[model samples]
Target: MADALLIIDMQTGLYDGPEKPFERERVLATLNLLIQRARHAGAPIFYARHTGPAGSPIEAGSPLWQLWHELEVDESRDHLFNKTRPSCFLGTNLEQQLRAAQVKDLVIAGMKTQFCIDTTCRVAVELGFSVVLPEDGHTCMDTPALKAEAIIEHHNATLAGAFVKRTCAAEVRF
Candidate 1:
């Protein structure tokens, strides 16, 4: 089955503020490597950008809604999906795009360990696509009760066996 890499909600708004989400440099580095590998393997790349209502940081026309500069998104080869919700498949044409690309397996990498990343992984699996999660490729904001590293570790450990096939960036295969 053909595979596509779904990069979910890796926008500036989530990582450019005074208090950013997770390890910006590490996550970006891992994602950059994933992008290179996926591109070389001929795997389709899809980006999901989160948008919110007016006045929100993630407002459609706001700079925060844009993907981080490091991504260097290539319009020619990458598919872009703008979404208002956490799950990329919710209220978006992501399903259609995947179907059109004949993608049966989804390799996910992006932001918010408890939000967009987790939601998309669950939804993709429920939608019958084999899901691959690069362990070091996703991150989240720190909560009052937990640190960012703890949250990421918790999710990776718990979600590894059931929700998705969790592996390191280097282990991700098409």
Candidate 2:
């Protein structure tokens, strides 16, 4: 089965806001490496952008809605999906796109470790695709209940080998 890299919601709004999470640079670096690796391996790279309603922080045309500049998005080579919900498949054509590409496996990486990342991972698994999550490829803001690092670690530990198989950016193989 063919595999594609699914980069979820790595938009400017999530990383540049007041409640920014630590280790963002590290996550971006890992994502960049994964992009390069996916390209070199001839795997399709797909990006998901979250578009909030009008007046919302992530509203369309807002700087926060754009993908981080560190990862260059080549429209010709990559597929971009704009989502209004947490799960990329909820109201979007992600499933159609993946099916069109004949993709059977997905390598997911992106923001809000427990929300968008976790939701998409579960949905992807339910959709019958093999899900691969790079341990350090996703992050979230610190909450009163848990630190950002703890949230990330908890998700990685819990999701690994269950909802998704946890792998590091360097260990991912096409």
Candidate 3:
């Protein structure tokens, strides 16, 4: 019945790209707020850094693969891991780890709203974990078909009902 915080792919390179994620500062601020609140509530914090192929933005051990410098993380207490797929559960031991820690609920937030956030939230529910997706806590860069804001809006609406409990960062409860 415990809740855990899963921060996915909020890496430095994502922000250093040509187009920064939409509402970059807002998302970071919201994430920091969530981090502080989760810490106070004694919730387990999990950081999932996405690893990409060599020479890619998020290549393993590369500076781009590192978490955003502005994001707050306490390595001493928070769990850290890497993933190679869009869904954190795929190609990762996230599920087993959460189950082992008795975490049945999750607060998922980070970058690439249309990909990692969307995929992870859906998969988390399928795995039987209740998920709270903070609408303003995840973001992405603009694409040819849609603006970053539009993508965030679309995903938030798309995943709001059955897939995840949708809420803003301020309303999310640990």
Candidate 4:
């Protein structure tokens, strides 16, 4: 089976935000570079968008639900899936698509470090796929209790090599 790159929740809302994620530009650069690498390697690349409830920033058909402008999506090859839940497989055809592509491993990246990224990585493991989380490719906004940096660090430390191996974006292989 082949490996696929699973990018979760890298949408416009995360970029154009009242509560901005730390180093969004850096995260985008890392993600874009890796995405290019995956494309060159002929690996499957799936982009998941979180469609939040109505009135939320990412409500369906809104500008915020769109993919970040800088993140180029190739309609001819790459796939984009909409999800209401954190885990991309839930209520989506992600699992079926992966299985169809013979994907044995998932190299993951994207937004909201403590939520969608973490949940998707864990669920991928539970569903019997090896997961490689790119440390530099996911980000989150600061909360009232924790700084964005601390949240990123905590998730990296806890989730890194926990349910999946954590590698730098440049080092992740599809």
Best by lDDT: 3
Q: Candidate 3 lDDT, tens digit per residue, 1-174?
A: 338899999888886677888989888889999999999999999999999999887899999899988889999999989999999999888999999989998999998898999999999999999999888899999999999999999999999998988888888777
- Per TM-score, the best of the predicted structures is 3
Q: Which model, 2 or 3, shows the larger lDDT?
A: 3
What lDDT does each candidate get? 0.86, 0.88, 0.90, 0.87
Question: Could you tell me how far off, in angstroms, the CA of residue 123 lies in candidate 2 after the best superposition?
Answer: 0.5
Q: Which ten residues in a row have the lowest lDDT in candidate 4?
A: 1-10
In the predicted model 1, the residue pairs found to clash are none
Q: 49 in model 3: Cα distance from truth in Å?
A: 0.6
lDDT of 2 by residue, 53-116 (tens): 9999899888889987877677887999799988989999899999998898899998889899
- Look at candidate 4 and give me any clashing residue pairs: none
Residue range 1-174, candidate 1, lDDT tens digits: 228898888888887877787788988988988888888888899999999999998899799999988885788878987998889998998998898988987889889888888888888888988888888999888889999999889888877878788888888876
The regions of model 2 sitting more than 4 angstroms off are none
Residue 128, candidate 1: C-alpha displacement in angstroms: 0.3
TM-score of each: 0.95, 0.95, 0.96, 0.95
Task: Show model 4 residue runs off by greater than 4 Å.
Answer: none
- Rank by lDDT, descending? 3, 2, 4, 1
Residues 45-122, candidate 4: write the lDDT tens digits.
Answer: 999999989898789889989998898678789989999988888999999999999998888888889999889989
Span of ten consecutive residues with least summed lDDT in model 2: 1-10
Residue 80 of model 2 has an lDDT of 90
